[model samples]
Structure formats: C-alpha cells, structure tokens
Target: MNCADMLNNLDSSIDTLHTRTKLSEVILKKGISKKDELIEYLRAELSEAFDCRVGFWLQGSRKSHTLIKPVDKNSSYDIDVGVYLFFDAEDEGLSASEIKSTLKYALASYCEINDEPTLQDSKNACEGLKYSAFLTIDTPIYYIAHDNATPMLATDSGWVDSDPKAIQKWLTDAQDTDDKRALMKRIVRYLKAWINVKWNGTEHKKIPSLAINILVARHLKQFEREDDSFIHSTLSICEELEGFFKVENPLNGQDILTLTYEAEVFAHEKLTELKAACLEANDASELQKCLIFSRLFEHYFPQIELSAFNRISGLPVTVTVPELTINHYDKDDKHIRTLNINEVTVKKGESLTFSITNKAHFNQYCSAHWTVRNIGSQANDANDIGHKVVSSITESHQRGAAYTGSHTIECMIFNGATVVGANCIKVTVKPAFPVLRRKKIFKGFRR
Candidate 1:
C-alpha cells in the first residue's frame, strides 16, 4: 500500500514500544546566540515591565543542537528561526484570543499572521504559559502575545513568538558569521562525525532532540572521506532529500543531512562495506563495526535468485522471506494469473481439478488471468492453438480428461499489466475404452 498504511499496519501488528526519554537535560545549544541575545534582551525588558520570569527562547533545529546550517555548498541563504517560551501549562484560563490581543496591544504594528494566530497545542492540555512578542525587522521590539508557551507563528494566531521578519534578518545577517546558527550547524556536523567514528562506542539514544541530525551530518562527511565511486549514490540521496525539502542548490551541495539519513538507515550496509574496504583500519572499534555491517549485508542483502515457477500442481506458489519482487510482463502485460483448462492435460478421459486463491489481493482487488497454452507439436505449429485469457476464476474447477495425445499445457497468470508466471503441466491422454457397453467383463477390465 502506502507509507501511511504501512505505518498503521505495523503499529497494529506490534505491541506499543516504549520510547525512552531521549534528552534528559535541556542544554541551550549554539547557532542562535545573536537572535537569542536580541530576544533575551527583549524578554528582560518585558519581564521587568510585566514582573514575570518567563523567557523568550529558541527551539527546533537550532535548539535541538546547532545554529546556522552548514554553508550552502551551492549558494548562501538566511537561517530558519523558531522561538519558544518557558511556562507552566496549567497556570491560566485566559483564552488564546485574549493573549493575542494583549500581545498586539503591547507590540503594535509588528509583522504577524493577521489571518490566523500561532498557537502550539498538545494532545494533552498544558499548564503555566508564557507568550512572546512578534517583531517585524523594522520594529524589533513590537510585542505580540504574553503568557503562552507554544511559540510557532502563524498567519492568524497560534503560539506567539518573535516577529518572523526580525528572525529572518538575523538569519541573513552577514557580519556576524560566527553567530549561533553557524556554530550550531558546525556542532551538529561534529556530533554527526563523532557518531560515525564512535557508533558502537557511544549510545546515540541518549543524545538530544536533534541527535539524529548529528548522525546525518557525520555520515555525509564519511562520503567525502571514502571512495569516489559512491559519490553519486551519496549525491543521489542528498539531491533527493534536497528536492524533498525543496532546499536550494547551494544549500543542497553544501551539506549531507539527507545522505546521512539514508546511510544510517542502510547503516548496516555502509558499515559492512567500509569494513570490507580495507583490513588496515587502525581502530579496532571501527574494525568490529565493519565486521558487524559485513554480517548484516550478508544476512539482509543476500543475493535473491528470482526465478519463475514451473509446477502446475495447484500448490500455492510463494517466494521466500525478503523474497524477489518479480514481474512477468515481458512484452505482454499482466501481474497475476490463474490455472485454466484446454492446455491442462490429464490421461484420456482423466478429470483434472484446479483451484484459485485470493492470498495476495491488495486494494481494489481487481482480477487475474487464467489461460491454457498447448505447445502442440512445435513452435508456431498449426495444431498449437492458444486460448487468450478470458475470465477471473475465484476457486477450483475440474476439467474432463483430454482426447488428444500428450501435450505441454501452461496456466498463465496476470495482475494489472504485469505478468506473474506461466505454470506448465504435461498431460498424456490414454486410448479410450471400446464403446461396447453390453455388460461385458472384458479382459483387462476390472469389474
């Protein structure tokens, strides 16, 4: 089916897996110091003005770890800024609208979503809240909301945060090259590299919200350290994710976030390949991981010998686990086929019985093709008549024995435009009994 469906199915099939808390202690990360400096200054002003300890902060990609993203390998751009406010979820009963009105009153003419308010909601209702002021670049101090915690800005209203314009300006600022965003991106890259160098040595599960990003960044660096042949596959993943995120060329070429993801996913594969690359790796830890990956590749990517089925015994045909995904639509178009007659041979007057199944029916549950081909005589022989696939058989059927001599019969299958296989059956017809039925217990006849 689809990814969503697969996820749903998997969830239903397995017991709930308890996800341990990933980040035990929250550490304010680098890459947003400039933005943070301005915001913190504002928070101090507002807190002093309103007598509250609530602070305006940053989160998301930056808070998770790094600040400015890696330089765009292809070009340069501004950073993405997200703001957060620390507050208890349950301290107030004021409606979201009231908070927004208060924020607008405090910070007039700020850039904010007029059509909708930005408010972050949890499945569970929250307690104690602190709101943030929105700032247009022109008016960095214009406030928006107060006492609300969730801080993503929206067109109308949601969680209140710093003005989008103000944040965007800081993101584009060129003078402060060593600011938080750049530093964070570097830190994330280092973390990722560290993860790569120390996969088994350290447990990644203990890392922060953006620990995986570290993994991605490190893996990307690995692509640069190793062989050139893999450059494209890694590039393909980078481009693919870049396209997925709709990142610019410069941004895309500069980092390995997506490639690292794919690498980690196929971590077993890459690790195994790296291990086999050389026996001279000085690090025993790396060597051990290399061996682990090698074993994984051997186990998972084991060569699959895809082959067509040749038996016609009505026995259900199935491939092995991690089985081959095969299509038999060579020139012809079909996916699944059913067993049929005419080409199905039995001894003279011998009855043949066959059955069909719905084991692999997916959505839509369309139909299957059942045909009998008689390779009578030879290729293109006149006696060799072929029956085109006509109907979708749901169950089994018995066909009276054939009157013709032995012939090769095949039951072809199809699904949509793809062909599944052609199962062959050999039937040899015996000579018929004499038609004299005068109650004769003739010789060679069992009474």
Candidate 2:
C-alpha cells in the first residue's frame, strides 16, 4: 500500500474506533432527553420557589457534538446546563449568594418531591445532580441582564459577566465558514480520545474539553489532503504548546489555564510525546506507521492481525476473492431490494448493508474493510459525509438527509494481510420527501 492508502486506512480505523456506535448514540440521546426534562422541571420549580422567572439552555461539548465516550465504561459523563434567573439584582435586593441559595433550595425541594437523589454540595460555579455513578448534570446559575441580554454567573466572589453562548456562536460560525470544519472536529475528538486512553487512571487533571476545542480552532491548518491536514494541525498545535500552555477563552480573550503547575508540566510532557509519535509516523513505513498509531491510540485503536504475512520472505502473495452482497432498506425498516448491479438509486435516509462470504475451499481467511466516498460535484471531506457501522466482515451505513448528490461505497476483502477482492457500488440519493400537515377544518356556526 502507498502513503495515501495507508493514511486512508489509519483514518478509517480511527473513525471506526472513536466514533460513537449506533447503540451508544441512542443511549446518549436518551440521556440528553432525560436531562432536558430535568432542566424544564428545574426552570418551573425555581420560578415558583423564588417568585421570579427562570430559563435554561445547554452550553458545552454536548451542543458541539465533540463529546467522546468515557474511556472506562464505569466512568461518569457530565452535561453542563446553564440556568438563567431573569431578575435584577439591585432592584430585587438579591445578592449572588442569595440567588444561589434559592436555586439550591428549589433543586433540593424538586428532588424531594420527585423522590430522586438530592444534589451534592454546590461547586464554585455550579451544582451537580448525580443521577448515577456514571452520569451527572452540572447546572450553573446565572442572571440575565435586562438591558443587553448578557448572562452573569453567580459565583462565590460575586456575579461575574459570562456568556457561554458567545463561545457557542463563535464555534458555530467558524464551523459554518470553514469547509474543513468537520475534519477539525474529528481531530479534536481524536485528541480527546487519546487523552482518555493514555491517562485513564492518572490523577492529574484531564485537559479541559473547551481548551482542546480552542486550540484546534485557532491552530488548525487547512490542507487539500485530509491526513495531511490532521498531521499538520496536530503538529502545529503541539509545536505552539511547547512555547506556552495558555488557552485563551474565545469569548473574553482570557486565559483559562486553571490547572496547577504540576498538571501543566504533565500536559506539556504528554503533548511532546504526541508530537514525537506524529513525527515518527510521518517518517516510518506504511505498516510501521500503523503500528505507531496503534501505540499512540492504545486500546481505542482497532487491532489488525498481521502475523499471517511473512516479512522475511519478501515475496508477492496471491489471495482468494470473497463473494460479496449488498442489501438496501428504506426508512421504515422494510427491505427495498437486493442489489446485483454496481449502482442503485434511492431517496435520502435509506440504509445499505454489505456482507461478505468466504469462498476459499480451505486454508484461507477473510477480513473486510468498507469505506464510503462522496463523488458529488461539491464534496467536502468524504470521510465526514456519512455514518458507518463496521462489525467483523459485515458493514452497514445509512445515507444522511443532507447528502443529496452521488456517493460510492467500496468494500475491500483481505485474505490474511493481502487484499484479495474489491468492489464498489454507486449510490444516487435523491432529495428527502418533505412532511405535509393536513389543513384543519372548522365547522361553520353561522345561520
């Protein structure tokens, strides 16, 4: 394999391991739904308890889709929810501490009434709701400015002006304007996953998610090639970190390095290690590069069996091809048709499943790799276009609604370490059908 193919394989492997599986996605959605319900209940309860208006919105990695699964299955996940109390402090003679106390009281009352666990002690910025050992919600109380609609957090010191929405808006705008934003997000997740995998049991403060986002957004260098861009952006940020370890808040231009000196030192050291790994991978052979990446990513990287190939022989090996089949399904979970040709047309939101059958009579092994590439006229990054699920020799993918144009799904069957057979199918996805609501009719009462 050449450099491009090697990099493609690496990218696919990382995506397959790092991206959330369909079941995990469903679980996450359910968690978010429960959190949303809790937030709504809190809004109403606080309003009733304090005799003031209250509202809330989400502001964190949850909104940005950069959240990664916990490295350990038992580890906890947190969602940051900002609760806004819409009342003037001076007019109502309410202090920051008073507001926080009132909010806590309301939350406690809510827990008691709902027969749920009470929140723990309030942190410097927020109060935590412990749903389980593996899930928690952090709600920070804020006051909305009547004049300008700015949000001020209730802190121990005093009410401090802070608008998380501003940062969210900045990220949204940056992603919308840059064509390479999807790649940037993936790189961010990769870095986060690396941190998770490497420092699973370490006591040092895990790098803040916001800090990684800021660094990636500020230092990412766009390139024509996806792998080149990933390497360039990661190396660029790592090099910059060698000079200093401060991450500026995009909203207020303030340094948010709250970690201790020892933590900072450890962060710099880890970044250096990452930089070295990237450099080594850049200079190594294709297979060697894959091994280096596997080391860097550790358990999060999928394992590829390479013992069947002999490095000492240094001779070409012929492999047998495996029989492949493609099955298509509609949104309603009904089978649309079985595809025999290399091309098919379907509406958006349709699903496709690919399966492989080992045809070798004996003494052969089969492993399959699948990838989908956007062949449309206006393709951004093909890897970022659709969602795929890879399970052993079988792979499944669903066409996204926004992905209208053309795409090609390719499957390569490997007999041991050698590519034995390859096949691709072209997909022409038409626009999704729009929902239409029936007009309501009213009976006339006129005489």
Candidate 3:
C-alpha cells in the first residue's frame, strides 16, 4: 500500500488510541491523560533549553502503559519516553554532550520546586546531534528491540511495529524506496540502544549503554545506504563492529555470509565455527582476524561505532620505520657510507645520529624521503604527529661523496614499525674519540 494508505490505516489506530480498556492496574484513560499532560510540560521546558527554540516529542510509547500483571496501590511501575531537542544555538555551537550538560541544568531549573530540580534531566543521543539535521533520541522501556517494540495503541494498525523483513523489503522495493530508508536509519538507532534486557544473559534494567547504542546507530545508518545485497550490508556491519569494539576475528575480509543463504539464519552457528576457526588460524593477517571478529560483533551489536554519546575514535595514522642500516660494526659488511651507530636510547629533546654514506639506503638523488613517528608509544595520543620527513638532500648527484655521514637522510626512519620479526637496526650518536695532532715533519724527519 502507499504511504497514504498506510497513514489512513494509522488514522483508525489514532482514533482508538484514546478509547481505552483497563489493562490490569493501568486505566488506559488515566494513562493517556497523564501522557498528554507530561508531553505538554516537556514541550514548554525543552523550548527554554535551547533558548526559546522549539523541541519535538516522538512518542514510541504511543500506547497506554498496561501492566503485564495486576498492580497494587503502592507498586513501582516502568515508564519510558523519547524526546528530541531543537536547539536555538544557545550552546555556542558546543557538542551535544555539552548541550546535554546544559539541558540538564535547564530541566532542573524549570522542574525545580525548590533549589533542586525533581528528577535528573535525561539527554540521550541516537546519532549525530552535534552536526545533525535535527536532534533525535529513541527510548523504550517496553521492548528489547525496535523490531519488536510494543505496538502503538491503534485499532486497525494494532500495536507492534511491522516485520523487520517487511521493512527491509520495503526499502529496496522500487515503490517505497525513500520512506523505507528513512525508517531503516531509525531502526538502527533503536536497535543499538534497545534494552535487550534478556540478551545473551545481560540484565541491565536501565536504558541501553552508550557504546551499544552508538554501534546500532552506525550500522543501521550503513544499512540505509544499501541497495545491492542485504547480506553484504549485514556483513559490512560486522566488519565495522569489529573495528568499533576493537575485536579481533579471523574472517576480517572473508565473505562468510555468502556461504550461507543469509546472515540472520547462520548468525548463531556461524559464530561458533568462526570463533573456533579464529582460534586455530594462527599467524593470520589482521584482515583475517577482522573477518572472524566482525561476524561476532554483527550478531551481538545493533549499532555503529560512533555517536554523540560515544563518538567513534578516528583512524590511527600508523607509520612504520624499518630498522634498515649498514652494519658499521661488522668488519666484513662495514662500508664508507651510512655507518650504523649505537642503539637508540634517549628522550625526544636528546639528539642521536648515525654515520651515513653517499649511497645510503635513505639517501635519494631524486625522490626519497625519511619518516619518523612515535608508534606504539603509550604516552602519545593518536593525534600526535607520528610521521615526519627529517631531511632530503637533492644534492646527492653532486661531486660531494659522503665519507662520514650519509648523503641521504630520512627522519621518518625513527618510526617504530617492524615487519613481524624484530628487524630493527638501532642507531645512536657515538661518543667522540680524541685524535692526537702530530707536528708537521719532512719525509726524512726520522733522522
């Protein structure tokens, strides 16, 4: 059916939303009343949060809260809601985290009966609130996953959301391409943060954690861009998750999903096999490791790697400096140029040098450069400049032949990168040796 048709169906659902039946302790009438009132209060408060800007309220709990079992007069109950903020630039363009911190104070200020606000203002981000088209959040206390959220209180539409398969099909379907994709993004975020209160034996009663939520949002966002194969999209999600969670797998680049009819089906069995295979696949490439771990991440996580709550880390600019040098210490291999110095051991400010020749490995008459970086340094941040070109001598083709230091020198040679086996050649400036000065004498001076 068309969106209009679907929307018409929703219209009927809306009518019956207010008309209620008693579900255990919750009177549907009273619940709806309470919900409406709460929404109004929220609308007003969120306006001031962004300095009088409008905020939106998307009701995931569009139905009345009905207890699964009967509730007594004084029993605790669960209530979950989703609220999106429409900022008014009050944050000076600060991050969503900063805005969240600000909004907390705003909510407290408004809800305050006294010096303190009643309940802590909750700010959850499903994705890109910092640079978002609009701020968004998806919250549910009722269900573990968005695909299985408690259906809205509607008459014809019933309550639960449509099938995941249906949603997937609709996105790829030529008819509802746009709408379906829009929804897929929403689904990713929701699944990422879904309580999954009963997942693989997790018992988090509160909302979903930050990392999982980000994971879901990211993967779903990826799935939205897919038009080729569902399995590919799913597998890509796994790959991303492996990187995201820093998980190691054996199937990094392998398309294990193609081995099965579909991913969702073999997710469980494939997980066991892949895990075992990863264990046995000793000395596998990082790609192979990523392959195995991606699948595991795919099965467990529904979100992406980055979000407002848990921004994904940027890629590490890795540069390796091979320990390549001429063995000046070895009598047989010693050369006139590029003499290997002592092993490098000093702080950054302390300088070190190596003897080099006119035909040094790092020297270039034309196009060669050296790189230096602090790789694998625990104290260095990822943003630290890990690669640098120390010196490049274009004058190597001249008559100058380097007898002491080399003609070509590369600074990046200091980057601490080795190819598996410790192929390192350490270099440090040697202590200067004193040479005795002899007085000028003629050839017959011995007489």
Candidate 4:
C-alpha cells in the first residue's frame, strides 16, 4: 500500500490534537476584547504616571494567528502586547530599567483591580493580570524614536533594538496563498508540539517557539502529500542544524538560539534523534509507522487501519536471484553514470535503462518479465500501477523518470508457469533542481 489514506487520517488526527490545544474563536474574541480594555487602561495610567505619550499594539503569536496552548497543561497561554513610548530629543536621559520599573509599578494597581496579588516581570516583558488559569498577557515596553526609527525594547540589561511586529509580518507575508499560509501555521504548530513534548518537566533549556517558526518558514515546501511536506521540512531542518545549530531573526539578522553551549549541544542531539525517527517512520510499514508517530508525537496522533500491498507472490526453492544493472542517461542518450541499486536517486526528466542478466544457470526455456510500480501522489495522478509485464524479452527496459517519488521496477524469470528467479530495484526520482532557498531577503539568515 502507498499508505496515503493512512497518512491523510494521520493528518486529521494531528488537526484534532491542534484543536485541543488551540484557543477557540469565542475564547479568542473574549481575550482580545479584554486585552484591548487593559491596553487602554494601561495607556491612560502610564501617560498620567510618567508624563509621556505612549502607544499600544498587539504582537507575537496572537497577532500572527499562530497562538496555541503549551503542550504541558500546567503552562498558561502567553499573549504579548507591546507598549511603545515615543521619544524625542528631550527624552535622551530616560533609562530602560527606570521605564521597566515604572511600567511594573503601574501594572501593580491594575493587577490589584483584577484581584491578582502581584505583578511578574521578565527580562523583556512584565506579566500581569491573568485572565484565567490558562491565559496571561505580557507587556513588553519599547521606545520609539521621534523620526519613527526601529524601536528599542526595554531589556533587563539595557535597551536593545527590536521590532516585535516585524516577525509577524515576515511570517505572514512569506506565503502567497491562503492554503499555503494555513499549511505554514500547521507546520509551525507541529514543530512546537514536538518541542513541547520533548522538554516538558525537564531542567534542560527549552527551544523558543520563535526559532521554530523561523525554521519552519525557512524550510517549508509544498508537496503533493501533507506527510511528504512535513517530513521534508523536518529532514531539511535536521540537515541544516546538524552542520550548525543557529537560527537568525529574519528582520534584523540576529541569532535567536540563546542557549548555553551545553544546552545547544543537547538540543542538537535531540533534534538529530527526531530526524532519524521521522525518516524511520517514513520508510516503515503502515502499522509500524503509526506506532513511531505515536511515540514521536506523544500519542497525539491517531491510529488508522491500513492495508498492505503484496508486491511479490509464489514461493519457489532457494535459488540465486537474477542481477539487475541500472544506467542513467542524459537528454542526448549519452551514458552519464551507473546507479547503485542500494542507493539510486534519479532526477526527473532523465532517462534510465534497466537490464536483467541471468546469474543463475537454469537449463530450460525461461522468459524474463518486467513489472514497474509507481508510488506517490505524482504516480497516482498518472494512474500507473505498473502491474502488467512491460518487457518479455528483457535485453533492457528503458523508462523515463517522469514523476517525483519512490518507484520500483522488478524482473521475474518464469520457466513456463513456475517462478525461478526475481530481482527488484527501488528508485527515487527527485525534481530536476530542488528548491533549497527562498527569497533573497531570507538568504543571509540561512547559512
């Protein structure tokens, strides 16, 4: 079986997991309304307390429509709302620590009004007023120049150049269509889920969701199968991280992986393990694939009943199998290179010749029958199952790499009506020139 149906079912199952963690429309609407009310209240309080003009806007996952509850049920949803203070030539003496202190103090009264005891402060944001057990809003202060230059965030150490909304715009504008955009979100959510499950309740440093989003957007590619799209992105990311464990903020070109050297190595090893497991799942049988997914995703994926295809039939006495030789040819039919049967990856639009040589000496009138089977969305579109015999005299059978997927060709030696020897070869056909890079703006952040 191609396992497409099972994979589609797995996709739906993943959506179910996402739905469980994703905030509902009604809840989000209420959260937004409450958030806006708090923003207005804080705007008034800060302006009166600090004697400076300020602006408020939503940012982060909420604004980008990529918010999801953390995999750990104990963790609350974090919504980031930026508070910008426009500065002129006269406000040069203001300090980041002082501004953060004043903001936290002002939030104390609001938290009191909301029946919260105290306000919490982080390196970049002040956390205040939990709307519920599952939600908390974070206010990160920023100072904007009079000429409307890049905003500087009030960090614990000092003011640092930051534009919280730039990432949202970069992520949203990267995709061209709504479907592509939705798929991007799904991909990001899946990666987040993996990380959430990995480091839950552990002392190890957790990978930030921002880094995951950047990597997903960087490596995302659309495939005919949803499973293929996900596996390819994951494998591509693993390959990249294997060489170097670093990711840059798309807008300002800053390395976002702020983990200790030990932590970085740990995360890299774990991600490499994830890549290996994903590849194993891709090549596994249907039932085994479901189990691997369950373990990889913490049982969030569902199990589906799948049927396996019998690629071979008829049993015979032990005998030496026939030898199959494969050669790749260019457009002009010139011999380019011979492919190893164990690792044959052909490029689409190229021509390949498969010849069968009888290695076992059998004194009988034997005929060589060839069968080609194509598997994947591309093959399915062509409606080619390739069960019938294509060549009976089998000096060589030439075929074009017309599709991009894993396909197989088999040669069976038949003595009258009984099977004698058989050999099968699996070939992987890839696109002529695979798309490994995105827009030029994103090029610097990759390497």
For lDDT, the strongest prediction is 4
**What lDDT does candidate 1 reach at residue 283?**
26
TM-score winner: 2
lDDT for 129 (candidate 1): 17
lDDT of each: 0.31, 0.65, 0.29, 0.68
Q: On residues 212-318, what C-alpha lDDT tens digit does candidate 1 reach at each position?
A: 44333323322222222122223433444433532221221322233344444554443334433322222223223222222222211111111223231232363
lDDT of 3 by residue, 1-447 (tens): 011121112343321101111122223334444445555665676565454444333332222122211111122222334444433232245444454445455444544533321443242322111101111222221111233333221112122221222322332442245654444443333232122211223232232222232233234433322211222334444566444323211222222122222433333343334334435323333333322222222212111111121111221233223233442322232233443442432222223333234334332332322322122112111112112122333222111111221112222222122111112222332223437688986677454
Best to worst by lDDT, what's the order? Answer: 4, 2, 1, 3
- lDDT of each residue in 257-316, candidate 4, tens digit only: 889888887798789878987897677765555445544554233222221212222235
- The TM-score, computed over Cα atoms with residue i paired to residue i, of candidate 4 is 0.63
Candidate 4: regions farther than 4 A off: 1-15, 116-118, 124-132, 303-447
lDDT of 1: 0.31
- Name the regions of candidate 2 deviating beyond 4 angstroms: 1-15, 20-23, 113-121, 175-178, 308-447
Q: What's each prediction's clash count?
A: 56, 0, 29, 1
lDDT (10s digit) by residue, model 2, range 45-150: 8888667788888877777777665554456567888898787764677888887887778777767765545587887777767765345778889988595877
* RMSD values, in order shown: 24.8, 11.7, 25.6, 22.0
CA shift of 374, model 1, Å: 74
**Better model by lDDT: candidate 1 vs candidate 4:** 4
